[model samples]
Target: MALLDFLRQKEFAEISALKNKLALLEKDIEIFREREDRLNHDILSLRNERDKLLKYKDVSDVDNEKERIIKELKDAKEELQKEELESKDNIEKLKKEAEELLEEIENKKKQVVELDNTILLQDYGMYSPVYDFADSEMYKDRLDAIRTEQKNMILYKTAATCSTNWTLNGSEAQGRVMTNQNIKQILRCFNDECDMLISKVKFNNATAFIEKIRKSYDALNKMNSKNAVSISYEYLELKVQELQLAYEYAQKKQEEKEEQRRIREQMREEARLQKEIEEARKDIEKEQKHYMNALLKLDKQLGECDEVEKEVLLEKKSEIERHLSDLDIAIKDIDYREANKRAGYVYIISNIGSFGENVYKIGMTRRLDPMERVDELGDASVPFKFDVHAMIFSDDAPTLETALHHAFENKKVNMINGRREFFNVTLEEIEEVVKANYDKTVEFVQIPQAEQYRESQKILKSLEIS
Candidate 1:
């Protein structure tokens, strides 16, 4: 219905209306995509160029000379005994610094791909694929045999997007073992708003969802997950009770001190001998003084943790709400299958670095559209018209997709289909990444075997409950 309505809302006749708007956005996406490709080319070229440019001036080859110098340095150091130490001491700092700088530069170069990918995603949303898909329905009726032609058909309508209700409550998807910080990062994706919003989704593909998880984890590894994870509300509530109790104690002490001060002031003028202080009065006063001091000290002690506690929980209701909102957004359904297309061959590729036979090349694209993806990544995506390495499709379509699963990780999550629901990744997320990344490979290896029956029987005889 949204697809139909959206198409109706647009005026296809106008050049600069909705259609134009979508087209322009696509154009922009294309430019970024092309730019990304150019940048990648530049990076590759620079990598090769740097290798050649490592020559030191006046030396035949800086690398060779350095090797010679290193050998001589090693021999001389052996002779001096302390030479090795001096060499290590002299170069370790420099080596460490060089490595760090190199990493920084590599990060900078790679950033172009990241930003370009983001831009491509924005483009998909602008030119939503819903309309395109809806326009692809091919009409058909009873067909004819070779002997007698039955009928002919050439009607077309667009495809439909799958829909689901929004009854997302945070607790259902609540994950365990996730830290407070991990949850916050996932929450940020939902708009950085301070409110709890939770939504459930039906993912299209489990593999794609896992891919998303891998990507998200890599992006937010340094972020703290503890904050987002819900501690025992019971425990926190208990802590609150403790806080309130301390607060009460402090207030009572403060009041008691005030009263004692008044009493002491009232008795100040009378001479020590003339005013024979009642033993009871003195005892009461002494008790009041001792308690007052103790209370003050306790107040300060509790005060020490005030900020830390507040931060841990301040507007926590609000924080949890914000996290829920993030979850809702993270679980949005891309459902690329809904998109209708005019295509020759389509290859949806993930990290193909390790899948050699399954992979054509290690290529990266900043765009999601097959056409723009082709233009951006160059030959790998569309090496030759008919020779498409692997025709593939992705679950995320119309709108660009990102890996929020990785962004959230194993705090607690239920990945239904290709969508993430019920939990945040605030725990040992990397392990989850590795687990998910190779999920496919692992599944193939772990399938139960027929020979395992004999092995199982032997194990049972050894000490098993058969």
Candidate 2:
């Protein structure tokens, strides 16, 4: 029994140890579960931190993209500013060029205007005197010399040109004959054209005629171009000069004719004045003799009369003495007029019917009665009477008239002929010139009483109305 109890205790001890080992193993399992839960929590926190880091990186990338866009915009702005400045400079250059072109065009227009003015002046017969001469005679002498030179040129065969060694059929003599004939024909044609144009040249057509001559020369040369025929330059220039000389000569002749007419009129006027003075002197002498005879008769009556009759005879003798004194004064005045040949009246007159307003004729007359000359001028020569603006008696009337003419030379009615006494000027302008030239106070009739002209105008108006 004792042995059975010992074995049973040993078995019990073994079973208890087995149970203790199983308990320890359960504690270790619980520790391990706690450790695993802690580890899972740590892993989840790390994962959340990694997600935060990735979000930060995405924000940085967006900022970098924005900076890049701003840099690109800045670069584009700088380029645009540069282009703007260059465009402005180009615009300024173009504007300057346009202004310069406008200025150049204005200068060209002014030059054209000046040329037109010159051409107009030439057309008005106001040539710039190509040849200066003392008189028509001098011009004639110059023309003769020119003709002699031309004749010499023609005689020397220098007036025309042609191929000197021209040949026909290889014969030198035949070629010479042909060349001579051709030269003669060409010269004759050219000379005839120049002569026709020159003869027809006047002041108005002189430029056109010269151009025609030049054209004719060119045409003839062109027509005979193969032959190489042409007029000499010197000969052509001589012909042109002859044309100008002929025109000037014609003008000079007209001036000479007018001058001769003036001289003849002056002589006639002087003769008339002399005859009138002589007649007046004879009349004065005859009147003085009659008065003296009456005085003698009255004196004899006074010597043989009663008191009342003697008183009457004495009064009559006194009247005759007064008449003789007046006659003697008249004779002295006549003598003074006869001695002073330059003494005359300068008259300013206007014929409104024949000439328009602002037109006046200034003239001088040596007549004792200046009105007589005025009346003669207002006769059949004019449609209406001349209204006298002023009649000034001057010791040197010719000088006064000439001075007035020179003062108003540009205002003359006939610009070509200076002998024309008519002037286109206002009355005030004339008065001012008169005051400047004349030392004495000159009374001018400011308003012209064109009675005949005004009356005729009224009558014409009435006729039109009727």
Candidate 3:
């Protein structure tokens, strides 16, 4: 039984061994199954890879795809390189443009500074040098000579002989005859001498030189005579006193003549106005008589006339009454004017300096002093005073004025306005018309005394030089 147990144990051991082997085989089979599953998955992955590889199995297709990828990558690389090169070139161009603009800005800044300096230089009188002659003896002598010559010229100019010409058989003698040409020549000479003196003086001395010349001129003028030359200042003073006395006497005589003339003119005007007033009264009386006669005739016819005839007579009577009333007013005005001695004057005056030649003002004034009226007209309305061509005292001055205006209607300066009594007629033409219309020999002064205007012009010219 023990032997049987040993054998059985051996058999059991074998069985156990077999069981262990079976277990090992089962674990190996599980492992092999898992590996088979993994192998199947790997086979599927390999088959997919093989299929994908099979698509490029043709060498030319594989080469074409590979080459296309490589060419795309190469083209992208080349484009990137080109872009990088172009970016580098753009950067360089921008840097160059920036540098040029900086240079241009610097140049414009320099020009602005230069312009400022130029303007500053000009304002300070650094453009040109002023002339100086203060240290030269020759220039001083020249200035002295100029001053003496200027003084002599002033003496000659202010001398009384300069006012009128001394003629010996229609030829001018050695007096300072102030014709326009002669005056212009004298001014030219004076200006030339002044320029010579001014040129020799320093800028600082210019004002003093002008002042001295002006003072010398005034002194010479004060010592000058109207009809004769004064040899020296002291002699001139005594002669001037004598001449002044004679001038006062002459002025008194002239005033007496004017007063006598005015008296004679007043007498004539009074007589003429009285006659006009008498004539006007006679006309008024005649008109009143006619109106009364007409009214009486109308009253006699009114009772026998038809309605229309009565109206006609009434209108005619009204018109005649109106005419008579007007005549009465006229007569009253004439009587008043005659009693008041308010005779009107028709004056012919011309300002040749202010209103060129051939322009004359024909105006009337009823002032007692007609010269006052003319002087008022010449006050400030014109730049110069007017010279009287004729002053006619008339009883019916408006009628005479109207006649003269009508005579020069074609020669009116302001043709559009009849009330503008200025005419472009010569003094001689006016004289002829006046002589033909009235029995009076009118004395007309053709020359204009533009002394103030000429002197003012000379002063203005000298001021311009200063």
Task: Give the winner by lDDT.
Answer: 2
403, model 2: CA deviation in Å?
2.2
- Global lDDT of model 1: 0.34
Q: Model 2: how large is the Cα RMSD against the reference?
A: 38.3
Runs of candidate 2 with Cα error greater than 4 angstroms are 1-122, 435-441
For all predicted structures, in order, the TM-scores are 0.17, 0.70, 0.27
- Per-residue CA lDDT of candidate 3, range 225-290, in tens? 443232333323323232223323333445456667767866775665566567767877887888
Scored by CA lDDT, what does every candidate get? Answer: 0.34, 0.77, 0.60
Residue 309 of model 1 has an lDDT of 68
On TM-score, the candidate that comes out on top is 2
Q: What would the per-residue lDDT of candidate 1 be over residues 1-466, giving only the tens digit for each residue?
A: 2432343234222322434444554555455456545545555554554445444435764666566665654554344444434444545554555455555545434322211233334433231111111111210111012101201110110011112221234442333222222433343432111111101101122222222333333444324222322222232222222223333343344545666775674344222212322342455456556645655554555557677664544454344455545534432311121122211122333222222222222122212234544444434553222112233233332111234233443432343222312233222332344246422221112112224344555887889544
Poorest lDDT segment (10 consecutive residues) of candidate 1? 153-162
> Per-residue lDDT tens digits of candidate 2, residues 92-211?
554565455455545433322111334535666545568878689988998888888988988999998895588899998998888888889988988987887677666676765665
Error of 2 at 321 (Å): 2.6
In terms of lDDT, model 3 sits at 0.60
Q: Between candidates 1 and 2, name the one with more favorable TM-score.
A: 2
Comparing candidate 2 with candidate 3, which one achieves the higher lDDT? 2
TM-score (C-alpha, index-matched) for candidate 3: 0.27
